[model samples]
Target: MTKGSVRSANGRPHSTTGGRPPGRPAHADPSTTGGQMTTGTTATTPTGPAPLRRPQWVRVLLVMLRALLVQSLWFWVWVLVPAAVAIVLLDRFGDLDMSVVQFARYGGIWYPFALSFIGVGIQFTVHVANGLTRRSYIRAVLVTTLLIGLAYAVLMTAAMVVERAVYTANGWAPYTSGHSASLVAGAGSLFAATALAFTAGGVSGLLVGIAFYRGGALRGFLALPLTVSPAVVVMLLTDDVAAGRDWTFPATVSTVPLTAALCLALIAAAATAFHLLARSAPVSKGLATS
Candidate 1:
């Protein structure tokens, strides 16, 4: 019956405390909140080393690997859909001469190169926003880039095996020969080149993304030629790849003066530039200074 008192069920007035009760959580535990039942998470986002914590590299690797798998799956589908359409059309009209291995090989180079932005453009922003260091994120991305490149190459080689069998079964021998660096190796050299090309693409993509992150759309556009140069160098390393493909290199690259060493050097240069630019990159709403 008091002004600020509440009546109990038994009809007795109880005085109000005017404060929250004890032994109650103000917010849910982060781990249990979103179904993330992680243990020993002392804080909302775990920072440095903890006795019960997993290694940062391990966590970073997992995030990178998961992203790679997701991207690679969709990428393979994109690669295969066009390939399937082309195969059907070519086989139907007897234009199977347009090699499937060669067609798919281009994807191995281009997808990773273009998708490399996901590393810095998307993942980096999220991770950095979540309190990760740029240095650690870049290192993890490099590792992921290497892995994705290797994965792209390996998948390419496997697809080639299928192409070879199917093409030969269809009485297509000309395209079946595939690319050999020399008389002894057709698949070996192809695999290595595929891996290298894919790797170059991934790193180049990463650098392109870094440029945009640091400088915005205008800078990204300006960096396009420099970013694409590595893939060009890789393509021109030998006559094995892009020899019979519809795509052509820049007219400035008059001759195939590039070598394996030079191609590697270009990839290394792009990767190094990305590292230098990104090592101290700041997360901001406005464009960064490169």
Candidate 2:
């Protein structure tokens, strides 16, 4: 045998190349190796975070409607319960001369209470919607709360009309020209109430939605002013009007129109504030994933 070549016992020349063939291992390559190396280097990187999604306007509206529906039903129950109890107590005690129209007007006093509950419900709905969609916070709050408030106003008006008709038919009291004026006043009241309620609710919902996104206790505290400011103003105005105090000459000319305009302006301001606040809030931490 030549010195350069070594022969095995089987007579085959010994190979010069050492180890495995020139190719990737079963689990290794430039692409695969690079990937493994990169993964190992960034092992601390968090996983399982969900990507952010934009909210759909229509879906947000639907969620709001569903929430409002449940709230409205509960409010109706609340009103009915009190009225039933009053009727029973009155019947048991004596044949009270109070007409159905009077009872209906009295029942209308519960509107604010019912509205407050509805506002809370709407806030919750907006929070959920914001969580799911991470939409423009202002838009979500305004659209949802405004629609709910409008619907509530319409329902209350219809109920008032129905109650009035029933009372008139039952010979409780004849519908007078003054009643027509009163109805017009009531309509103005409804418009004002709707605007104020919607504005307050929208602001509340936006704040709550921000809380849901940011994870803080401040939202709860902020919610108070957002909801109560408009309410307080409306109450004071209504009280003044009821007391026959006219601070503004224009307002005195037609109290209803003036009140309605003021209420609408407040609602618009609230909506604008909600939108601005939402836009200013930080993006949700959990929603920052790519």
TM-score of each: 0.68, 0.53
| Candidate 2 local lDDT, 133-183, one digit each (tens) | 435434554676666556655655565555446545654422333332134
Q: Which candidate gets the maximum TM-score versus the true structure?
A: 1
After best superposition, candidate 1 residue 269: deviation in angstroms? Answer: 1.7
RMSD of each candidate relative to the true structure: 12.2, 11.3
- How high is the CA lDDT of each candidate model? 0.70, 0.49
* Candidate 2: count of backbone clashes, pairs at least 3 residues apart or interchain: 0
- What tens-digit string does per-residue lDDT give for candidate 1 at 177-244? 54331112256556666777788888888988989888889988998898778876776563364332
Inter-residue clash pairs, candidate 2:
none
How many angstroms is residue 137 displaced in model 2 relative to the true structure, after the best TM-score fit? Answer: 4.4
Off by over 4 Å in 2: 1-55, 91-137, 170-227, 238-251, 283-290
